[model samples]
Target: MKKQMKILDAQDKELMTVRKIEREGNALIIRGKIFGAMPMVAKLTPAEARAAFSLLDMKTILFLLSFLFRR
Candidate 1:
């Protein structure tokens, strides 16, 4: 399953378009484009994923959870 998402800048202009998200082996891969031209790929290991999530505060976490649940 592929879920598409967008990243907007402060002016609400699209900076990145997340084209696909998938799991390969033990890593999570995020494929996207930066500034509409540069291709970008990020791989997150299990430990990296946990560390990344740990950076989010309670309010942001709650907002994301609410957004997902509302869908």
Candidate 2:
């Protein structure tokens, strides 16, 4: 699956543009550009992914779930 999205700040300013996100083996790869110019790439392993997600509070998780279950 291919998804192109723009990450915006609270003021609606574009912070980053996500060009692609994909899974490679057990890792998640994110390719994007910061400030619409600088190239950035991140690879998150399963352990790292879990650890990162663990930082989310219950309220945030519920808010995210709302989007997931949206029609």
Candidate 3:
């Protein structure tokens, strides 16, 4: 299965994706892109990873964000 997931901007544009996920003990090393233009990396705890994946994809994530901003 592919862990890579696409990320889009606020304007509904393809920004990047979750290219890599590396697990080092209790930490998850994530790598992807920003604004679909540049590279990005982060280290998250098991709990943080759960929260991140709770939404599934960028489309849904962006939708929820937009909805929140509209209010």
Per-prediction TM-score to the true structure, in the order listed: 0.76, 0.78, 0.50
Q: Per-residue alpha-carbon lDDT of model 1 for 1-71, expressed as tens digits?
A: 66679999999999998998899999989999998899999898999989989999999998988896684
lDDT of 2 at 42: 83
Cα shift from native, residue 69, model 3 (Å): 28
- Cα RMSDs of all predictions? 2.9, 2.7, 8.6
Better lDDT candidate (1, 3)? 1
- The C-alpha lDDT values of all candidates are 0.91, 0.91, 0.81
Q: List candidate 3 segments past 4 Å from native.
A: 1-3, 47-71
Ranking by TM-score: 2, 1, 3
lDDT of 3 by residue, 21-40 (tens): 88878998889987666899
Clash count for each candidate, listed in order shown: 0, 0, 1
Task: Put down candidate 2 lDDT per residue, 1-71, tens digits, no spaces.
Answer: 66789999999999999998899999989999999999999898999979979999999889998986788
Positional deviation of residue 48's Cα in model 2 after best superposition, in angstroms: 1.7
Report the alpha-carbon TM-score of model 3 versus the true structure.
0.50
The Cα error of candidate 1 at residue 19, in Å, is: 0.8
* Residue pairs that clash (backbone atoms under 3 angstroms), model 2: none
